[model samples]
Target chain A: MNIQNPEIENNVFDVRGLNLWYGNDQALKNINMQIEKNKITAIIGPSGCGKSTFIKTLNRMIENVPIVRTTGEILYHGNDIFDKSMRVEELRTKVGMVFQKPNPFPKSIFENVVYGPKIHGIKDKKLLMEIAEASLKSAALWDEVKDRLNDNAYGLSGGQQQRLCIARCIAVQPDVILMDEPTSALDPIATLKVEELMDSLKQEYTIAIVTHSMQQAARISDKTAFFLMGDLIEYDKTEAIFSNPRDKRTEDYITGRFG
Target chain B: MSAAKLEFLREGREDTMLETDQTHAFERYKVKIDSGRIERRVRLNNGLKHLFSLSTVFALVVLAILLYRIGVQSAGWLDLQFLTSNLSRFADKAGIYGAILGTVYLMLIVVPVTLILGVSTAIYLEEYAAKGRIQRFIKVNISNLASVPSVIFGLLGLAVFGRMLNLGSSILAGGLTMSLLVLPTVVVASQEAIKAVPGFLREASYGMGADKWTTIRKVVLPVALPGILTGSILAMSRAIGETAPLVVLGIPTLILKIPDSVMDDFTALPIQIYYWTLDTVLTPEYANLAAATIVVLLAVLFILNSVAIIIRNKFQKRF
Candidate 1:
């Protein structure tokens, strides 16, 4: 059964009966959800609950696992992402990802931010610099790294590096960004910075984040999805899910009764 | 301490232990040190350190003695005239000009061929190939080929490049044979270098919508280049100094003309040293000529290795 928000007919993704497996072990089971456009969707679950796997499926990056097998459909902007006619590169151009660890390339900060634009054939140095400036400002990292654009990215602190990764994603001009526990490795202050950055990012990009922290979901996300044992048990407005969950499992989980 | 104190320390603040029991606990808790065991361990550690240093010194001394002997033998014989002149029947007029040129020409072929073939093979195995029985079989055979005798490679090269291809003992044939001899080492080293590239970098590149080739070219190759270069240089050095493979390939020991092209007949430094050392019985000065040739070969290898180290350092700092 797919859950669609009747009031908001505009959806960015419509997943229908999606199931995934790694070799013989099932990782995601029959998930159906409609992600609305330009909204912050937070997927929170215990470890190994397949929230990460579900987000990776949106861009088809899970295919890199070599043993991953999926059945059903994921429609991105009305195109079946698994269709043979749909190019993976084209799909990924419209979608970007941020990993749990702050993975800035070993290149200079300017180079790291411009990697995507350069690969997409943007050769004009002036244009690349403009894009870099705009993306860094959007990611809220311009003030910290503006003076040292040529320094190696590894020189940045952990919080700044993660922001740089977000800036890197923004330079691609993607419509959606998938984050796999992007703030799990940061301290409380750094986590707060990223959360604030995410609040402003939703104005331009649709975001789907998988987080381990329930409080982070309540604080920043508009839609909340609680997954348990490879199944998406609840998906609704954050207030509804937090205050008046319809499912007993969702109520128990949010109350810290059992995972 | 006393049994009660010991229990208190072990389990943290036993409820029944009062402050009055602490008055006599100091005497009971007096420590006993094992000075004899400590002394024995310290002595053994120092003795082993001295023994290891002595072994290192012994090796260096032997190397120094050998270098001194070669230097003494080649001092008067090695000169600019000796380096410029060609081979002759008399020991006083002999030179290794042809052999030096031949060795340099041989490297021109081996370096490019081995690098292209070895790195390509390694990339195919590490990145493109599927993991299964067929890939495993190919990997096992490549490693096994590394341990096979270099002379065996010479025989294969002789049959394929010399007889079947009709290249004969030309520098082309000898260079191809030497490349085959060192191909396994290059392949193994390149594979290790490519395998050492971290997975996260590849993931990050792909996440940006870059395809496999772009990711490999931009991320993987730059990271693996230093290791691959170092390995290839060491392999080339081995090829430059090898005698058994050239011997099996029927390379000429003495030639009057320097090889201007790969198709021309040639003689290498190791082959010249072998022939001169064999002729030492008839002319004792031929021994000095062989020693002089050995010194030249060592100098060439040293220069090649120094370049490799410099390049490796330059690339290693980028990451």
Candidate 2:
């Protein structure tokens, strides 16, 4: 479904007629949506509604699955990401992602943060230190972990590790950040910290977060898309969608009639 | 009662009977739990613990006895004079200096060649190769190769490195034969270590802009280093103690001069022990010489394994 907003002049990602299948079972069916630049776009749905699969497709991360196949157009900055001329590494460099779990590398905190920059060939020790500092400050984890940058990342608490992961992604300096339930594994207070981080992060990078919590979508998102069984049921401003949903299923889902 | 109400009462009675039957079944289950079966299970668990301990003790006793026997035989004969002297026709004048040098030189070749070939094959199979019939076939064959008789590998090595390459039973041929013998073990172990690396780590790496080669070198290999090193060193130790492959490769048992290079003729510790044990029928002192050689070989293996354990621990702590 194409629910374009007239005010959104610059779209970061425009997914059109996207159909994805794992072997024979279809996971996403003809999905069409636009993610606006410099905004938090939340995808809300029940489990198994293809929210995670959809976001992974934007950066072609879903191709890691050997049997997964997709037929459609996912345009990033007006270029088709699936085209042969577009390199996956280059696309991923511009579009970074954070997973559901706090998957920090088994390395020192500084090493973890600098991994992305290092992969992109930043070899100067002083330059990498600066990048690590900036990214950690942006992720809001520098204050807690500044003294222990050389300590292993696994030594941190779950919340701190997740922030470290975000800092690692930020070090790459990507234009878009896709979060697959970034706060599902966190407590309410940690979740609040992440929500606040997202609010500030949007000023620097466009974000597409796949979350199971409608309250979170309402609390933090500028635009929200509701997916149901691989279909885009409704797409609109978060306030409008929460207050007066156009689709009956979206209203039913939000009101707890059914998932 | 009315007719409909009478029918409903009849259905309720049947439902009550079914419920009573289920209650009886539940009671039987509870009865079974309270029976002596749990006591029997507890007794079995304790008995099995003791039984496993006994098996461990038995193996330890056997090993201790073997070590004591070898130690007793090597006494006075394992002096520094025996270590520094060259091989001789008389048993009292014989030394393992040449054998020691040969074994060290052989390992210098085997260690590097085995690691390079084994780790590369593992990385190619686990990361780069497509998962299909060919990949499965290669994997199965590699595993099978691990179990193939070491003598077969020696024959293959003799045919390829010895005659075909015109190396002619030099230290290179013997070292190459031992490397072939242990290569499958290293490859299989490396593959398992690489495979055990969590998928999420790779996903996290790719989520950044890291390509496959970068991800493997930085993320996967470091995490798998300990397991890879432990497996490889254990396989190398096995190669050091192995005699059949070297024997098949026709490595000498009594070289007088120390091996200076891979192209020079050499005699390893195992080959010396093998010849000495056989010569004990004519000269009974050769048995003590064999025992002394065993002591030295064991020390070498012990040192190699200890170093590997230290390296494994260092890497394991980082992750």
Candidate 3:
């Protein structure tokens, strides 16, 4: 692989020998990779391969679950995120996440978008409205829903609901956005829309996406990381990994061999 | 052709035709017989079911008749004045004013306090408390308390709030006792209401980076409020009808004046009716007064329930 991009040196996330366990059952083992700044990095692996767990650990979201244990060093912009001084809420604000399913609160569409900002103590109505509008625009849902901001979010279509969730995350203005299969629950058309949105969002935010679809990763991501049995199999540019993978297992996974 | 061969063939053809006709006739008769039997059986079964249903109606009618007879016997004494005026020294002139005031006073204190304590306890148990032996024990005790007899609670109130606390025979003492008596019911009901709220709503709030308290405040509580209110109202209705505890707490059978303070002596509606029934003369005036009081109490209960239903409907429509 061509290792000539000096910009890659300023990785937003520099993971080193990350390991995770859920009470003696190892979920992630020895994952090491560098996620580039202002680029979308997609982690693709088969079911039960720790792709989701690895992403969750980035924001310390897994800490909420009892019996979950982790031993690792994850550097965010060269600072260890798991340090004692690091607050989980602060870390979460910096590294936001959208779940696999669209989970908009049973509230108004406007409320759903502004939920994050409100939690952070943003009380100015005008500012919140602007943020809500901008975030929805970024998620490509503003046009369809701008006229009905007060409508219940559950009334939206599945794809619209997913976009609303994305808008909610974006409203917080996080530096990094972590998505765990954001489009897996959507149809092909909705998936394409989300992929396009992700592409646009990468220009402003560093995105780490965990997807089950290899084609989706290849289509939307600038970098691709493949994992197998809780181990990082390969990490490279999207084109190189898909076309000329360095590891046999990575090649096999990309070519539709046994996952 | 030989004559013998032709004769044998003709005979076989004739025999086959006759047998076919006979079989067709027999099949028709059998079908008709089976259908008739099935139809008769179904009719008989339907008739038996009707008879059973009629018997159930008869039983209900008998119960209604008994209720009506008792009501008729008591109606002669029932009158508007008997409900509105205070009880007099003479059995015929006595009214239920003090009892009504006492019941109202007791409920005013019991309902609000019980509601607050019950809803808070439910929220704590359902949302914050960890699953452990202590939580389990508390849960079991709460369920047990709900099933404890009212008379036992009355005794408890007599000992704990009345004597032990030295509250004396006061409205405050009675109200506090009733609060304890009805708390378990309110808590259990509110807990069920809170549990009815979908988990997804909580998850959505959490995903938006809201803390546990904020999520519960903004999402869970609002959604569960209607159910909690309905449960609380039902529990309050039960509290209103309670007489054993008040009797045990030494609520007087009659009082000329309404209670002016929580520390003052009081009488409830049930105690007044009991007092009227105990009068050896069994006069029409006292009996009618008791009936009128019963009607007033029933009316109040109906109004409360209707209000709860209205609130529930309004909330559901909003959602």
Candidate 4:
């Protein structure tokens, strides 16, 4: 509710004074940050530091938990996502999410890619096929899966499944993509492929990734935010945050003194 | 070197020898295994597994003997005339035409009633019910009801549908009674099926901007449908084989005409077999008629059970 940072720019999201609780226990404390447009922002922290919870709160996906209560204001494109006048479905359509594990539906691969567009009321068959191909192509999956688009998505390997999820996320043409450790479940080869995809994806979409690997954050992100014990310790350019952190705690975490 | 330093060096050399021996025992050496002891353990494990399998075979052998006895008795009497002719006082002139029609009509009523009520109850409990005291209470009571005697459900049907509602031993009354008798079975089976759906599929639906109800209808229902169909088949088989409930409802055991409507009086396959078996005390020939009817009833049950398994296997989806 309080804005500590007075300066503003063409940021995609302006989050301020965000606090969240599950039942009686607080999960995320008062936090403030700005997310720039067309750039990949990485959130790095130890386990249970509220990285996943913070991204879930961005699209109100945490509302699925029966005991969750949040008091915050996240403005996406200058409109408050939590405002009563804003519908949650519309908010989710603009901000898509990919979970840690690959979770394709039991349906065919083509169905998985076009699920978002179908849910949003796109009914033309030709349009849906075109969307599926374009989305798969964008996720770097079309060449590998084009011949077997009608097969069940579950038949794919773990790496391919993750890319299918990525294709599903982009099918709806969302403005922002939020990934919660999308590479944690993948092999090193698949992890590198997704990391390479993220580099090119930032030209069109605002990307926010939560990662446990400090090197992954250093490798892919334009900006890096370090969180510890429900607090944002530092947020700066990726190089400065990793090389010569301003906060002593951030320096210690980067140099492997402690987490 | 001084004398004390020399003594210390000698102690260090001895400690090094002990450390190497300890490390060699755990980290570097491969201890010999006793193959004789391992062989004895494997034999004991296999013995228990074989015992369980033998028990299963023993039960099947008993079933085979019973079926063989009934098959021999029914071999001469099972014919087209035996199936098409109406029931008669003379054993040679009797048939099961009326019972077959009665069963078809009864199922027409019981199938829809049980399916709608049973499946709805399962969905409400599994998906909508909160994890609280009320949900737990309902779940325990439902499972307890499943284990209660089918004859108790018959008594309930007799008192409520037959007497209180004044339906008067009609096919409707019998059908309604059978539905109640099988309702608990259907509900329990459907609950298991719905619970078996993967959690990740529901999460995927919800993450794609679907509401709770939409997720249930579009994602959960399709995945759970095969299991639901399996449950319904078993429930119908249970209903078809049930007799005491219809008897308690006061359905006539000697209907001469086929039931043309749900409101018409009727008798089912089990009731026909029961009356014929009872008549064997007066005339020995009636025993053959009873055996023939038993063979038909068993065939129907086996077919129903097989259909359930086939449907389950055909529609099962891998996630």
Top candidate on lDDT is: 2
Clashes of each: 0, 0, 4, 0
C-alpha local distance difference test of each model: 0.90, 0.91, 0.85, 0.88
RMSD per candidate (Å) reads 5.1, 4.2, 11.0, 5.7
DockQ of each: 0.67, 0.85, 0.31, 0.54
lDDT digits (tens) for residues A128-233 of candidate 1: 9999999999999999999999999999989898999999999999999999999989999999999999999999999999998889999999999999888999
Clashing pairs in 3: B77-B288, B78-B288, B87-B95, B88-B94
lDDT of 2 by residue, B1-319 (tens): 4576567677875545565588799988886785488889999999999999999999999989989999999988998988988899899999999998888888898999999999999999999998999999999999999999988988898899888999988988988899988999999999999998998899999999789999999999989888899989999998898888788878875677777888998888989999999999999999999999999999999998998888777776443
Query: Residue A155 in candidate 3 has what lDDT?
Result: 96
**Candidate 2 runs further than 4 Å off:** A6-9, B1-23, B32-50, B309-319
| Candidate 3 RMSD to the correct structure | 11.0
Q: Residue A56 lDDT in model 3?
A: 88
Best-fitting candidate, scored by TM-score: 2
lDDT of 3 by residue, B31-62 (tens): 77777799999999999999999999999999
Residue B90's lDDT in candidate 1 = 96
Give candidate 4's TM-score.
0.88
TM-score of each: 0.90, 0.94, 0.83, 0.88
lDDT ranking of the models: 2, 1, 4, 3
Docking model 2 quality class: high
* TM score of chain A per candidate: 0.98, 0.98, 0.96, 0.96
lDDT of 4 by residue, B200-239 (tens): 7777666767667777887888889899999899999999
